[model samples]
Target: MDLAIETNNLKKYFGDIHAVDGIDLQIPRGSLFGVLGPHGAGKTTTLRMLSTILHPTSGEAAVLGFDIKKDAREIKKRIGVCPQELVLYPRLSARENIHLIAQMHGMAKKDYKERTDELLGKMNLLDRASSLVKGYSGGMKRRINVLMAVIHEPELLFFDEPTAGLDPQSRRVVWDFIRDFQEKESTIILTTHSMEEADDLSDELIIIDHGKIISQGTPDELKGKLGEGDILEFKIKEMEQRDEIIELAKTLDFVRWGKPVGKHRIVLNALDGLRRVSEIMDVVKVKMEDISVRKNTLEDVFIDLTGRRLRD
Candidate 1:
């Protein structure tokens, strides 16, 4: 396979902190690859190194076949980076912001004009394109930020939490844009804390924690690693009873594992889940407010591997 991005023991450090510790990756061309982790798991640092915004302390990587360290400028030219924090000119109008980015990328005026108009229309911001970015809603700014990144139509794109604060409708629009890009054979690397977004958008994903990869595979493959089972979630009427229900679940032979989630929920991994539901429910029947059973998900895989939830 033709790899769009590859890294070999990539490491970055800040004093004693190993922000990105020895990550090796092989992302194929045209794949919507996902990097998932919690707040301090080095997802942003890793992306910064890949996009040539930060030089790694050690190790190496290539983006679109150009060395990130030695050919940083060349790599920058072929890649678009939508950072976790918005990087827009608040004083500029939305169209002006995109136009400025296109100019910086050395795009011809005619090309950029057409590209900008098309993107604004697609994002449903054509009517507001003349408005200053400082006055735009958070979601509108995010949408413009994304457009600015791709104004030059780069071959490889890096989106760091692209839909972080978008409403459902706006988020779906971003998702659709990503899907359309993938269909056109552009390699996209995305980092997100949202498991649902990762599951829905990623062709393959890696879950990172403490600057190291704990799990990596297709969504279904990662879930399969949890073994054959259904995930049983119970919402208790009283939050104080969570631990007791989890302890009771642990005592069941059919249950592989159980843990308290949030304040009122207890999640369990069980075999023959349908057949065992009644037996499982009987234990928590008195305290249970609601219950659900489903196949394992990426979130469950994260909890199982890291011993904590994704947001933690």
Candidate 2:
């Protein structure tokens, strides 16, 4: 497999804070890779380092096989970074914004003209092409921000919270553009707080916590590590009742384990639940309607690993 990006022991320090603690990452060409973590998990910091905007405190990173330290100029010319913060003149029209970015990248007017128009059309901003960014909606501005990154046709793109603060329709538009870009063989590195977003679009997912990489693998690969077939979640009104539930749930042979979802919510892991929900429930002496059953998921894996939600 070809690597479009790589890092070894990448680290960044913000005074006393180790903003990006040693992290190793590998991204394959033409794949959509997601960097997922809670807010302040150093996602933006990592993107900045990968884009060559912020220098690493320690370790090595490369983009498109160009050493990030030795070939920053070439790397800058070949990659695009769309930060989480909005980056637009607000006074410029949507079309004008893309044009400004194109010109800054030293794109030829003849070449950029058609490419800008094509991207505008793809982002569904062609109709609003001339409208000043100041007058555009949050989603509209985000669409244009994304267009700015791709107008120059860079080989790799970095998107930080790309669809954040957008309506469902605009989010879908952004997703489509990403899908189309991948189809054209563009590699993307994205940071997102949305688990579903990562699950839906990423071929690979990396989870970070407190600036350190905690998990890295394909989505299904991580999910498969859950080690159980079905998850039974029981929400109770009181925490003191957990002892009774745990004692009752352990009587079933199919039940691998039963634990607390929180102080009051209990979760049970059972094998062959399709053949055993009734049997398990009988052992627990709880009504089937009282418990909720869900397949093991990445969310569960995160909770198990960190003892908290991905957003926490």
Q: Which candidate is the best by lDDT?
A: 1
Candidate 2, poorest ten consecutive residues by summed lDDT? 281-290
Candidate 2 residue lDDT tens string, 228-248 = 678777667756767787778
TM-score of 2: 0.88
CA-RMSD of model 1 = 2.6
Poorest 10 consecutive residues by lDDT, candidate 1: 281-290
Instruction: Show model 2 residue runs off by greater than 4 Å.
Output: 240-251, 256-267, 271-292
> What does candidate 1's lDDT look like per residue over 130-190, in tens digits?
9999999999999998998888999999999999989999999999998887797899999
Q: How accurate is candidate 1 locally (lDDT)?
A: 0.90
* Candidate 2: residue pairs that collide: none
Off by over 4 Å in 1: 235-253, 260-265, 271-278, 281-292
**TM-score list, all predictions:** 0.91, 0.88
